[model samples]
Target: MDSDRESNSSSSSTSSSSSTSSSSSSLSSSSSSYKMIKAKVFIWVDSELKDIYKIDEKLTWVEQKENIVTKLLPPLYKIVNKKYSITNRKLLKMLYGRWRSRHRTSNIKNQGDERVKQNKRRSSKNSRMQEKKKRRAHATNYLIENKNKYILRYPEEDLVKILKDSGYHSEEWEETDPEEEWPITQSAVVEDDEIIEEAIKQKSSSIYIHNKWWRSPALLRLLHDRIDPTVELLKKKPLTLKRKRAQSSQSRYNTSNVPPIGVPSWCLNQDALEQFNYSNVNIPVYDYNTDDQDNSDNDIEDENNNEEEIQNRTNSS
Candidate 1:
């Protein structure tokens, strides 16, 4: 009974140890799985957290230097699914700080531009477009400059137009002479060139009596500056009115009496040039000019023929 009891106890001990080892092994595996679940990082395009972001472990130096991604959101998920710490400064600089500094430098230049714009705005109140708004608000059709009193009460526009057209040159029909009218001379055509030169001066002074002056007469100067250079290039031109001059008939007579220029002495008549045959005539060819003593080979050597040439020539033994 003692030996059988001893064997029974040994087998019971072995079974208990086996059971404990199995329990420990299971607990170790569970703990490891729990740590894995805690350490896992998820990055995706949506907030539902169902998907895992595609992480590129084999990123090249060029791609890391380029730093194409610059966000920290979930929906966009501009970064990869790898976990980062602030301690990894080199990695952060390589991925983002490289390209971001370039944009920061460009923003610095824009800051300078913004400062210049502010200075200009402060210097001139009109630069902020305040005058433009006032001009727009007080705009009018300028029918005789705010007339308060008129003698006629009711004159039909058609009848007034007819009366004005008939008596355009007569000053008695209107209260003021027509300032817009000008004779069609060359000076009159270019009269709008300097129309608003003294407007700034007149604005400060009280006495500004220019009846022909209207709003924005600088536009007339601008039109003249742009039109004068390219007036000849106009494709559709009006009928040219030629003025009859006093000496025009005399000029015509003088031009008719004058001979046509650039006519050669030998080619005076076209019929003679066509009829004459050079083959039957002995035309002597002069190799040198007889008038030019220097070029003539007529018994003159070393340019010693003329007295002037003899005096100008260098002395030789």
Candidate 2:
């Protein structure tokens, strides 16, 4: 009976020890799982936090990133996994640098394109301005060259059209007047005279003498005589009609009677005066000629004096 009791006690002790050990092992495993669930692991992709994973403390930063990338963009994950053979820190830095470089390149390209467009616009504007200047110069030269052929009053557009219609190209002909289809009439001459007179009245220096009118000496003489005297009078005495009218009206108001409208005493003629005969007139002539010998002697003396002075200066030098 004693042996039996001893053996039973030994067996019970072994069973209790085994149970305690099993319970302790279960508690340790449960604690490790709880710690892993509680611990936080942050994962980033392209500088942005993608996900927070509850992972074991044993996981490295590289593993975490790889997991994140795998979950987000699979293709990028492959590229990162294949390219990144260095440490996690170096890999992050390289990725950031690459992104920055790509963005910078794109920005530079965009700026360059914009600059090119601006340059093109500036060049086009300059070309257009140059073309306008050339056209203006050509038109001015054309007007100057054909000044004597056409009246100044003639429209530039009309002149161009007329020249084109006459089969005369502006580039082909130079400093020459084209022949006209019709002859100039007396009426046209009168019109030109009227235009010239009006231009003179307006204090204009330029005259529009048509090709046909240019041939008439009588008309030119008449215009010269009229224009010269009128211009001189205008310069010497500028008449203010308004002021004169005012003064005249005041004087008339001051007087008792109105002024007569008849001709003045200086202009009144009774037709009884004898007219002078310029055809058969005899006039006394006087001869007071200059001495050529004296003038020649004086010129010779001046020349000699100039030569002597020049010689003296040369000798001194």
Candidate 3:
């Protein structure tokens, strides 16, 4: 009985130790479950706070900050320490403000970038247009310079072509060609004759005002007016008056009293007077003498032919 009592007491002591260890294990398990539940509850509370504290939806930067502060910070605060949680909120707000400011600056810079690109594109397009205009202007100048070589050489045709090539409308040149074709409607011939007269006046040989090869109408007219008085005086009193004065004495002498200047008395014979007399009348006498000789020869031939006929008639009778 004593040994059984000892064994029962020892069994009772082991049962008590086992029961205490089991109770301790149960307490530890319940504490772990409570901590897990608290962690879950804290996470849920953080999510709710994030939704409640969100800033304007348009301000996504601020919204992100609120999410980081509320949803993401609490867990980190628990791991780091509870004392830093208050300080983390202030730091988070400051960082979010700085981030927002930087974000706004970046947005402004992006707008400036777009404006610069647009201006560059516009400037490039304007420069290209200016270059095209310059090229077209050069082409027009070249055409105008070469207009004289046209097939028609008509100013109206040339004017129309020039206006057409220069980008002007046809209506702008509607009257240009016709106007050139009938340049002076009322008196073209008169104008042309006037031009010819002016040209002739300017082309005088002895009229050298400036010794130039050509002169304008204005210059030629000035020169003519300046020199006209002297030319008129020269025409009124010509150099032929001196020759007439010298010949007056020669006509006063008779033909027989005027001997030849260079004649020698020994060489002067009657043959010269006869030769002179014959030579002086030779042309008139030869002209009349040819007709006289021709009439005498015709009369002799007629008498001879009449005598032959008379003799023949006598012989036949």
Candidate 4:
């Protein structure tokens, strides 16, 4: 009986210990399930770190504060705003407010938002690059049209002749057959890229403003305030002015000041002055230049195209 009692007590103690361990494990697992691992973002901005709470243009004030709390580090998020001067504060507001994604893109955001932001930035960059390329191409065409106007570093046709002559014997260097296209090499690709970059920087050097400023470099001062952010700068045109009908200079000059026959001078001077300033007049003034007007019948049916594309997805699917 004494031996049985001792054996029973030992079994009971072991079972109790196991039960306690299982309960402790269950509590730990429940606590762990409630906890979540959050993702973090890291950025390396201009070598010197800035000290301020960040403001976002796209996001509201509440969202900005939330982003500051969740995205920024503890030290950065905790920084308080100081009592700035009235003028300085207003200027700062304008500076921060001038957030145009079309020209310049911001990088501050969460991981997912950053991806979308980067895509927009890339598109903007590509558009700007295309515009620059187009401008350079136009400049090059102008130079070609008036060869004597712009002085070339290499005026001789030696390079062109050599390239033309070499084209006949391209098969010698190419790995493929003469009938097939030659494979693109790394050097050829790099050279093409370098040529494009060099062409854009060759012209449109600040002609007027750069020389006008005597002592102070006024370029930085000019950039101090945003230049009408809501409205975009008009597309720059060529330097040449286009002349209309009445080829003679005297007739061209007098077209504006002289009132038409049948219209009185007093009437022309009164209401027409302000109205004609914006390409409008009380009486019809024939514009000889604009002959071809827009015909809306030529517009593409984008919705129909989209519907057709969706319906025709069977082959791919």
| Top lDDT prediction, candidate number | 3
Q: What are the lDDT scores of the predictions, listed in order?
A: 0.30, 0.34, 0.37, 0.31
The candidate with the higher lDDT, 2 or 4, is 2
As for model 2, its CA RMSD to the true structure in angstroms is 50.3
Give lDDT tens digits, candidate 2, residues 1-317.
Answer: 64454445445544543455577569879867544422211123433433432322234445555653445444334445563333445444444444455555555556888775555544543453353334433443333333311122223333233322311111110111213422233323246446532211111111111121111222222223212222232232343211111223322222222112221121112221112112222321111012235555654454355456546765798
Question: What's the residue-level lDDT of 188 in candidate 3?
Answer: 27
Q: Can you give the TM-score per candidate against the true fold?
A: 0.14, 0.14, 0.16, 0.18
Candidates 2 and 3, the one with greater TM-score: 3
Identify the candidate with maximal TM-score.
4
lDDT of 4 at 165: 32
lDDT of 2: 0.34
Candidate 2 residue-wise lDDT at 295: 50
- Where's the lowest-lDDT run of ten residues in candidate 3? 167-176
On the 0 to 100 scale, the lDDT of residue 107 in model 2 is 54
Ranked candidates (lDDT, high to low): 3, 2, 4, 1
Off by over 4 Å in 4: 1-49, 52-89, 98-118, 121-286, 289-317
**Candidate 4 residue-wise lDDT, 141-205, digit = tens:** 22232331111212123212222231111010101122222233322223644653321111111
Q: How close is candidate 2 to the true structure, as a TM-score?
A: 0.14
